[model samples]
Target: MPQHFLLSAEARNLSPIAIARMSEYEAVMTMKKLRWGEGKDVICPRCGKKHEAYYIKSRKQWQCKECNYRFSVTAGTLFAHHKLPLRDILFACSLYVNAAKGISALQIARDLNVQYKTAFVLLHKIKEALKVHKQRETMQLSGVVHMDATYVHSSQKPKNKKSERVDRRLKQHENPLKRAILVIRDSFAKQDDEQNTKQIGARNTIAFIAKSENSKVVNQLANKHITKGSTIHTDESPAYDNLIYFHDLKRVNHQKEYRSDAGVTNNLAESYFSRFKRMYYGQVHKMNNTYLYEYANEIAYREDTRRLSNGVIFNDVVSKCLTSLPSDDWRGYWQGNKKRVETLAA
Candidate 1:
């Protein structure tokens, strides 16, 4: 698809608010309805031939007449091979994406009334889905791209046995088990030609969970999505000092001045992190690195779709979940939804 057309199509479909209010079962059923026979014969997986298929809503499966093949709607998709009711999965995804910070597995289990392990596994699956979607897109964070980092605690830390050098090192940096999230924000130009300042436009976020605050990591991320010569804004963290090596880097020393000649700052990204920290600290409390990135993507995805109505968000997430690639598992589907959310915001 042409980039603009694909983007516009996604924009028309993107909505986060709607998804928040939906029950998991309803979302799954709705997705099943959209993917089922819409005046077209179901293609037989075994023969690759179009077959007459009838929907058995009770079982949520399709029975083919020509081949006598019966398959559940979730058979080939991520929803297949799961023992959890479709409703619980859908609800988990809804809760997962809607929260600004994140929902812990225990909380998810409580809300869905499932086991903690079930909730944990479900969250991991959805996160894996989000990761697949991230790999599919090419980001062009043109205009002003704000960059910054925030810390999130890991789920577990090794016990200290003795004069523990590693433990001491970790404590020196405000907890060694904490992971840093590097985020980038796109700043749009505001009206008023006289001010000539970049106004905040639609906001989107890309988060990386890293151990060390290093320029190499920042540049690696920049090279992936940002175009050459694009204006980049960041605080005077030594790690970001080398950004000029790649893009049009501009710096604001938070220790001194907060703005530069570009009249832009990393405040946008910082504001996002503040919201993230509140949720991470207040609601969920703790998360491991494995799940931290997923939660970050979920939060970012919701923020991108905050303006849309609840119904729109629900439909968009379902649609993106259906069409996303790599692994069609639950995690892949959510990741795909996140990618679509980011693209629409862009």
Candidate 2:
């Protein structure tokens, strides 16, 4: 959990060249086997049975002994439905882990010699897989938890709806459908211990869209993601007033001082918000509200695992893809459904 552990994980996984050096068939076979179970035991994607299928070498698939069904290693998974070769998939994964900040779909297309559509879908699938991992493995923050909120405006814009009469203040949020972010971080926990059991802080993050920074919203978030008796730190926000009775509440007055007499500051949460805002405004350019949860989840995952090596991060993302269902398809991706991100914080 000490920062040194991230450096240690770097030298452990095989270099990208080594993984890329694998034959197309070999790489596919190896990763698929790893996804299903042991590298030797192939799972029947049709029936979800392990060690009960025979590898049909000629056709490169499995014959489930139980169901007598035919399937490929990628069958039933997002990779199962893709037309790209397994090697290309693995290489794309390598790119994913290497680009800690994030690699755009255009970059992936150029690197893999694939169409923009293919690259975009592949990356979105991985992000969605990350979302599934987040939802399934939601962590509760204990010791010294920090909570704060920020906003990311909707990308939608009005072409001619705006006129000179528009209030100057209203112009700032043209698409006033602002997306509120509620984030909580464990100030006392490390990402993981030497054993990699994820005890202290491997996955301790709470984030999701909120309606407003109101007392009801803060109170709900505190009760849900934060555990009882844990100390909560924040700025002098009226919304957090309700949390005082339930939690060991402490606050810092930003107007007068950054830190209080008790050494309380929501700096950790602010640091996370700053990084997220930069990534959102600078890198991603714009975010559609529909997939906001997945994007936020990616931020949490990246920040939480920032210390881990690219190889380890790549491996973890791919492992989660095995059980993850794909998100909205290509055509529907941009068509926003405007789902209320509240109550659905990953």
Candidate 3:
């Protein structure tokens, strides 16, 4: 039998050990190349210009010709004011993208020999960077789109004394921290002309957080992400009933069967939830509601880029981090400057 793609030698291109062995100068040069490209021009973070900057060799910074602002390679980027070595930062990011399910801050701390707080803040900064990068590259999804919502923090454990436990299924007893992650995935079939067969899966994915899978929020997100007139497959959920007004909607009654006689199914979206659930249960044991959207989006990213080699994924993630602006949300996250409220759609 043919071997699975993920287990194949071709998919194992990156090594965290190699990244760890990189010299300080090598890490610095790599970041500079990723941030500014191979050209001589370095954009001034202060003035936002691509003009030439005076490279201060002694200080390892560039002074903007127009603004005279001295900035290091990470200045004004997601790693601004970073305390960790460049090599360690790169190694941490490598480990992050290499994890198929997810990596917790505890795991990062153990791997990098850093404090738990530092690892927590560092991982969150990477998450924030990925979220922004996804937003910056937003495009309308076309073709077969599958959308579904999975609830997090929705279930409560039963009391040891069964008599003392209330009916948790009731709306009044539901966990108030509960939130839904709505994932919209665009799938496509690549025709193998030689074999006259097709390969199918989700090509792109977009995720959002909402209080619940209500019609208003579902319609709003579908309209914003999926292209008009695209064929959307969903399960038998009333929230998706309204999507038919603007696009072609197909439904599979999951309670009765996984697929309909007409081949209607929401397997694409369900596949995303499968990996997300693994991340939730296997890696991140608990997820706070405030930053749940970022976690959801991170899984969406992993699903979309699953076919790429680890090396490619690492470089892509590092590039996005370098291009992302400094994050205020994670700057002083452990301090009193936490996000005041959860980000949710109506």
Candidate 4:
């Protein structure tokens, strides 16, 4: 529970040389070392066969002596089809993993010296890898827990004269904005986790960006993320009424009192909501629902790993980048993709 040891100035695994390599060609070698291992058999991504491959220096690619399929160091993976340098990719990973509150795409663009569009895609790609790897992890909340649903306003605004006129027409309907999110965090969730312990603590959370907070949706979220027989503290929203069937539901009526007889409250949800909202307003001023949900997942991931060192997080994200597949789901995220965000989803 002490401040994550790895983030301390002396505890970080990143060295001056490594940081220097992040801006040089050595970062590509670092990627290859982490992804394929040093001095090992070359495995063809296309054929899944081991062959002695030769480096085609002119192309900055590899040639499988067997299939003759030529590829760059980042091909056939999450970083495929990228136009940026290899070191810059690793540089972005370092910035993202250690960012406690969260970093903006604009900030990322400035750091990488790339266009906003490239940074947008790059940040999401890293988040997508982290998200894919996190989904493989099984987390269940137990003991006292807090659950709540809140609507966050979108940051999208008009950029041109024509769009400005259209925004004026729709201003009346943008009150509650685009998405509703559900946050599930343990009330006694730890601000930090014990590194050697195997238990997933209360502060750990799972969330979803939802469209509707109906009975079935709320019930399904409760059933999936929370343990079978735990206490659920929430406000008097009717959306949570159906949760009584399984959870020991405790309600706090904000209109009259903040706490009930047994010290029941949704304080954790309020705190988390404030932080997430702040992150949204400060870092991501304009975002669509799919990426917003991805941002929520990033917040949860940050909290869950808060107790660990930044070095640990950096290594974890690097591993995810090498192993996880590229996400095709980001199509139209900022370009008018209006499909309903996942429902009854964890």
Candidate 5:
């Protein structure tokens, strides 16, 4: 078949489903390249002058003529100062983007044949970039927003063993697990006037955090992402007792029954946390308290967007990663590889 004729025939025979699938497939193949040729001149890093640069593919380094500045494409990128292969970085990124739950740094290191520390750093950088993008793009949680809390404790011994001894006794007085607040919007709430009972489906979580389940954090998150007058459902936690001050709070006293005054319950959020806890324990095994928020957000983001195409997720992550780069460098790098990256990620 002629090339154009074959292309046209393919398009003609494509169903709506097939076309959508093809678009996703096209996105998954996108790749980003800095410069194409061996002798292409690049601007000097220090002098800001154009100079003939030679790319040594074997060493993956470039030598500039103007200032004798020698650097690799990985220089200044998230992969900079790392000894891992460029291919490994790319593969890890692909794995992170595609994994439904998430792969641990240990698993990544084992797969890539890199040190555990390298994988840890890479994951942190990627998570930071993801968080940056998420904060930049504000998403509103509408309808019934379920609010609840869970606990995650670190096994690391406290610096003060004396205090730890006291804390152990304190734990006997209270919950042993560290507190983690979970707020999820039931995106599947449907009003039924005829039956007078709203049907609630599986929720798509908006935000999940390991912060204190106190009123302050709850109120702050509510004020930030949730719109005013949205129905907020939760258990009879003292923190959420005052939720009515900012939102239409519906309380479900689990002790008596699981239904609130507004006929709502936090079963969805509870289920979400249950699954989240299992995944965290199963995959990550251990997460530092310092980076808990990033880790939680990463899991939540992946879960919420699991149904999305790998290419779409890849582009989303890449855009975020690019934003973390210097403005000039971002523009230059993106201009060169945006189409290619999109093609691969699509």
Candidate 6:
């Protein structure tokens, strides 16, 4: 049998040790290449000009000739005002891209030998960058789409005494922090010229967080993301029954079998949930409701890029960090500047 893709050497294009060995100058040059490409043009965030800015050798910043505004490589980007060295930031991205499920901030702290708070904020900044870049694309999934919902923070721990334990499955006993991650995945289709007649796997994915998996929220999200007339595959949940009015809906009853006789299945969405559960239960053991959407979207990104090599994923993530604007929620996070509201789908 052929070896798996990730187990092959081609998939191991990036090495964290190489990034760690990079000098400060090499790190800066690398960031410059990723940020501005081969060209020497450096746009001043202040003056908003694409003209080549004067390089300050001592400070390693650019002075825009247009308006005399000075800016560093990370200025105006998600890594703006960063306290860590550029090499360490690049190493962190390498580690992040290599983690298949997800990497915990605690683990990152131990590896980078930084404070837990710093590692936490650094990882969040990366996530926020990814979220922003994905939003900027304004992606809309088409073709064979799979939709499903999964719950987190819904189960309560049992008490030591059997008599003291409450029925957690009961609606009233359910944890109030319970939230659902609604996933919609677009499947990969075979090209017309290809001899393969089978369609397999999900190509792209989008996710949303809600208080619960209800029809109102489901309809609203599906209508917004899924194009009209696209076929949507989902489980036999009443919440998805309403999607039939907008698109061709196919349902497979999980209570009976994973796939129906007609070859209908929501496995694409299930595949996304499988990785999410690994990240949640195995890595990030405790997650608050406030940033649950970010976590979900991160998993979606991982799943969609599963076929790509670590080098490609690393470059894509680094490019996103460079292009994403400074985060409002996490800029002064350690200084008590934080988002007070939770993100929920309407």
Point to the candidate with the largest lDDT: 6
Q: Residue by residue across 207-313, what tens digits does model 3's lDDT show?
A: 88998999999988887888999999999889899999889999999889999999998888898899999999999898889889889989999998898899888
| Candidate maximizing TM-score | 6
Task: Please report how far candidate 3 places residue 222 from its true position, in Å.
Answer: 1.7
Q: Tens-digit lDDT track for model 5 on 130-230? A: 66666677787867787777777723355565654445445354543354746565556576687685535544565555435777777777777788888
lDDT of 3: 0.88
- How many pairs of residues in model 4 come into backbone collision? 2
The candidates, ranked best first by lDDT, are 6, 3, 4, 2, 1, 5
Candidate 6 residue-wise lDDT, 175-265, digit = tens: 9888989999998886634755453588899999999999999888887888988999999888988899879999999999999999999
lDDT of all predictions: 0.64, 0.73, 0.88, 0.74, 0.61, 0.90
- Tell me the tens digit of each residue's lDDT in model 4 across 1-346: 7654554775566543365455445676677777777774556788777755887766767888888888766777788877787777887888887667788989989987888877887888887887787789787888788888777664346556774544534646454555778889984534336554444434777878776566777888788788877999999989999888888999999897878777878887776777677787777766666467778888888877766666667777777787877666555556754346443363
- Deviation in angstroms for 181 in model 3? 1.3
Which of 1 and 3 is the better model by lDDT?
A: 3
**What is the clash count for each candidate, in the order shown?**
13, 1, 0, 2, 10, 0
lDDT of 1 by residue, 1-346 (tens): 4354223444354243454466655555566555553554565554556756776666666777767777755665545577886666666766665554666788898988888777876776665556557657676787778888876564345556655535434545456466678888776566647877543454567777777567878878888767778888887788877779768888888877777665767887877777787777787776655456777776666656655544466555555555443353334333343223111111
Candidate 2 global lDDT:
0.73
Residue pairs in collision within model 4: 189-202, 189-203
Q: Which is the better candidate, 3 or 6, if ranked by lDDT?
A: 6
**Each prediction's RMSD to truth:** 8.5, 4.3, 2.5, 5.5, 11.9, 2.0
Clashing pairs in 6: none
Q: Model 5 — TM-score against the truth?
A: 0.64
lDDT of 5 at 308: 53
